[model samples]
Target: MLTVAHSVPKTPEHEETIHKAQYNVARAYFMGFGAPSSEDDGRRWLDRAAADGTRRGSVKAQTMLAMLFARRDTLDLEKSFHWHSEATGNGSLESQGALGVMYLYGLGVRRDLVAARLCLTQAARRGNIYATGQLALFYYRFRFYQHAVRFGTHLARFEAADVAELARQSECLPGYVRRGLATGCYVLSRCQLLGQGGLAADGERGRLLGGRAAELDAATADRLQRLFVNGPWSCASYPDLGVEV
Candidate 1:
């Protein structure tokens, strides 16, 4: 039975009904609609006409249910996963990314690198910049150096990848991988500068890239600068590379 009301045409009465419906939906989702302990009760309201027949309603219900389950320390992982997965399947980019995160962390399922990669790749292909950044971090941390290089290359070529992508992913990845990527960029720049690494490594060009990195994340950049100053191989071998806060 379609218990929830459908959206009405523009009119004072219709507007009132819409407002009431919206409130009920929110209440049912957050406050449990007088059914706080029962998933079936919550589902009944969620499955009402408003959610069942409308895209927006469906998305709202799905997100709410997902969050509800996620907040429960003892929540059913399978249910949470299913709700989020359904939301993503319904064209919710946020849900898509969230699902990717779930896969990455193995929240509701077994840890699966390939599945995580697939989810992130799907979101990234859809212009989800966060997903792209996440994928970059994943590759970097996993020692997929070639993949990281390709991702960096793509960002450089497209100009769509912002510095924020690097920053966001940096929060989740190991310090070493972040440092390594910066180092790789520095090395590449040096190659361009002076005609090394299959090209001339240009000091001037290297400085430019290094300077840019420093500007983006000052701490990492400074560490990198010091490392370069000390000599690459020597820095690599040094216990701390003399990097200080």
Candidate 2:
């Protein structure tokens, strides 16, 4: 398979075809499918593929390259930004979501809430689970009520594909605790608390989510206190809410 795939690069063909072949071999090498596992070789091939990916911007190659640079274990913000920016421009939902996240937190580029919000909205519409969750948090933080109405339900996706996405990206569960998605969950729960979105205002659900977040990290507990206790979310307004701040 490697031999057959490698031969395509030497044949006279379009750059896209050649790059696609190269990316496959690189993936094989990186994952030890048809060749000895070699990060260096895989990276080399990915670089070549990403360079040639320019015409149409190969989403697979560039997205993988971006992940190589941005994953927690190997965070190379500059290269991540470069590849993500390229693929994002080419309309890769994965890249757009990733680049949007970077923009949201100034990971590689300066924090541009405008660009981040635009990219995230696009990604969320495209069904990027992480993007939906992120937008829920973003909208809630900015008090974008109408906007929150669109994406706030993402928290409820914990049992569905969003969990799978988090697992694949290694960014849900434990990772989200660090990245503040857990907190995002709490905020969405708050939305549930106040029926901010189209939700029917269920404090039981709110406590369920907030309780989950509080169980995960102490910092979130502090935040919960501030928001539920000291903030405008008065339990007195509705005495039925069983949980105290």
Candidate 3:
């Protein structure tokens, strides 16, 4: 008696193809790109992709899962943290940034500034602009003036015209990028005004940078002004000033 298998057996050679297909299927279901939106079905396919032995889709699938679980309506911080940690272990840059934020804010794990700085620095070095801004702010918060200025100056390199252009295309950019840019500009401006870092005092440049920060993210600029006085690093010390597009 010959028994037929229901489906083809999975092999290492087929892993990449299967992972890609699974990811596409998940996207279609999740975003209604070609199929009706169904988070449940999307998650199922994503899980399969994430489980691929080759680890090709490990970062992508886990990152998406972490983000999906972090949504307000489906908020599951622990699950989000788990997926982020897994993706980070698999060398996902975005996940590294996310874990930095999680550690910074203690989203699903204990607050740890050292870990947050390490994660943010790793991502920022790889050109994650948002992480660059966050790392600047992190250093500023803890009174590491030199380090903060280093990153802030990197972000404040934008020209006035460039800032205006970014504002024009703001809708196309991610909110995090906008907020991060704003943070960098704001911190650099403050450093210029106070001469806290090793840079020469330049109130004119500080004001210009501050104006640019306001143009990009007025709310954050304003909030930081009110919250500039730094104290010990505690949960209450850092306020999450979220600005949106």
Candidate 4:
């Protein structure tokens, strides 16, 4: 399946088709979808896909490369930044969100709330639901100039209503995000846990939301499993999130 794509060179004759084929083959291999998984082949094909220079969906290849290099075990932050910067410059909301997260955690670049805000804003404005959730979680309008102060200020100004607004907006999200449904449900579930938006603190609601998210997307389910520590929905103990986003 993987070699089938490269058998026919990607030329001007069938550039779009070839690019799509290569990307599909690479994604299939990467995900082991009816094919033997091989990261090396997947990465090679993704590189070819990005090199195709198709502005339309090349961001997907670039984002994949960025995440591949940014794996915690690999820790090649420079390459991660390089790919993410490419995707971000190409107007990829997912890449923008990822770059914002990198800046926020100082993964590759220095920690800078300004940079984070810029990237997050770019993604959120384009209707990246996860980016919207991040924006609601971390507000950066104030001129705090320090991490602790900025963080404290955001917490102080945080309101439960904001969660409801964010959730309402993310209900019908764009298709650009592969896990938009799962992410939205997860964010809303967190809000439920916190008793935000005039809602009661309900662990069952949180679990139900998590389960629904997992049903919609397996990746989201895996993320929920990590957060729950037991299953997709159940939690041994809920954390204390008192008025803090």
Candidate 5:
């Protein structure tokens, strides 16, 4: 039965029709027939479909191509930045986040903290969790500076409220809640320890919160601890500073 069906003579017209049907099926698969389990397979079909001028395939291909380039550590940062920027401009949130980080670290462009903050702000507004964490950290550092300028003056009620809101936003971020929690704990600890911004001295509570921050991520905890131990706070500029609990 199978051989008989296979032997059915196909006219030139029928052959053309079959070819068109196959192409249509291929197009469907390219769009995500089973969503291709392997990256190589997905890329292969996406490339074919993109070459055939399918818009969705082209967009997917471009996004994946940018990702592949960005993942290569040895790739030129400028090229990677360009690819990511293009993808981001096309409305890829992941690309937007990647570009934001590159800008934040000055990987390809001149270091511009303001620009980095702007990019991250855009990503965060789009619901990127990492961007949210970055924003939270930025605000936390800003509050610290504000507190320092006042020479341990109590934080204005509004400033305190802002800190709390930033912290809350950070914690609510989907993928970065732990990091946000750790950051929040660190900021709270600093506020308590230095008696800055009109906060009462609470060495015990500060130590506990600091320890909790470290518990969330050992590396972050260690870094913060080192900053506490060796930073200018221990010097004459800021006296009586120690990390001991």
Candidate 6:
């Protein structure tokens, strides 16, 4: 009997389809979307999808694994950072933003503000709303109020969807968009109220912005108020503000 050795499809289209299917399978297992929900199985499939190819893994899979490892009950910050780094090298905007956050918070490595700023700036310039919001917060913390205002204003004026519509269909919006919008409004309100960030004192506008922040995401709004408004702000002591990309 002749032995047969199986090889991965050489066609790029075929390889792409296989990788996508692997991701879909992982998602289905994770979410119970036409499949039984099983985190173990989901993780297994995700690993396959993320580490299968001769080239770097699938960006989506790498990013998702990073998020999963960072957030799951059994957290693994090192694994998360590794995958995010890998995906960032692949030019994934989401991973770039995530890497920035990890660096800012010292999640899996030594905290490095310069590295965080570099990663956040690259992602923010490429339209990563999460990165933009984080950059605003970073600048604000460092007293670079002008830069904070610039980034915050961009998020505050996100007009892709009407506020009322977004409120009515919050679930339809990406987590990053909602969180970014809320963070922007909250930051701007603080700026206006305190006359920082190159903004004049405007309690009325600040109040309105505060209200808008609540509308976009009450939980995020509450978190920001508790961490930055009602108490002394400390980035090291701040709670997680991760965007679910």
Which candidate number has the best TM-score? 6
Give lDDT tens digits, candidate 4, residues 1-245: 44645666555646545666778888988898877999887888898877633464456677777777766565587778778888778766677777876676566678787898888777767656556544544431232223322222232232323434544453322332324445555555655666654457899976776566566556644754465455322112211111001
Candidate 5 per-residue lDDT, tens place, 107-161, comes to 6566677877788678767655445444544555567444332321222112222
**Of 2 and 5, which scores higher on lDDT?**
2
Candidates 2 and 3 compared by TM-score, better number: 3
Which ranges in model 5 have alpha carbons more than 4 Å from their true place? 1-75, 140-177, 224-245
Better of 2 and 6 by TM-score: 6
**Structural similarity to truth (TM-score) of each candidate:** 0.46, 0.68, 0.77, 0.56, 0.49, 0.86
In model 3, how large is the Cα lDDT of residue 78? Answer: 82
Where does candidate 3 clash, by residue pair?
A: none
Among all windows of 10 consecutive residues in model 3, the one with the lowest summed lDDT is 1-10
Candidate 1: what lDDT? 0.52
lDDT of 2 by residue, 97-205 (tens): 7777777766667888899889878876765655666677677767885566555455454532344455456322334323244545666777778988667899898
Better of 2 and 3 by lDDT: 3
lDDT of the candidates, in the order given: 0.52, 0.64, 0.73, 0.58, 0.49, 0.75
Best by lDDT: 6
Residue 32 error, candidate 1, Å: 16
How does candidate 1 fare on TM-score?
Answer: 0.46
| Residue pairs whose backbone atoms clash in candidate 2 | none
Considering only N, C-alpha and C atoms within 3 Å, which residue pairs clash in candidate 4? Answer: none
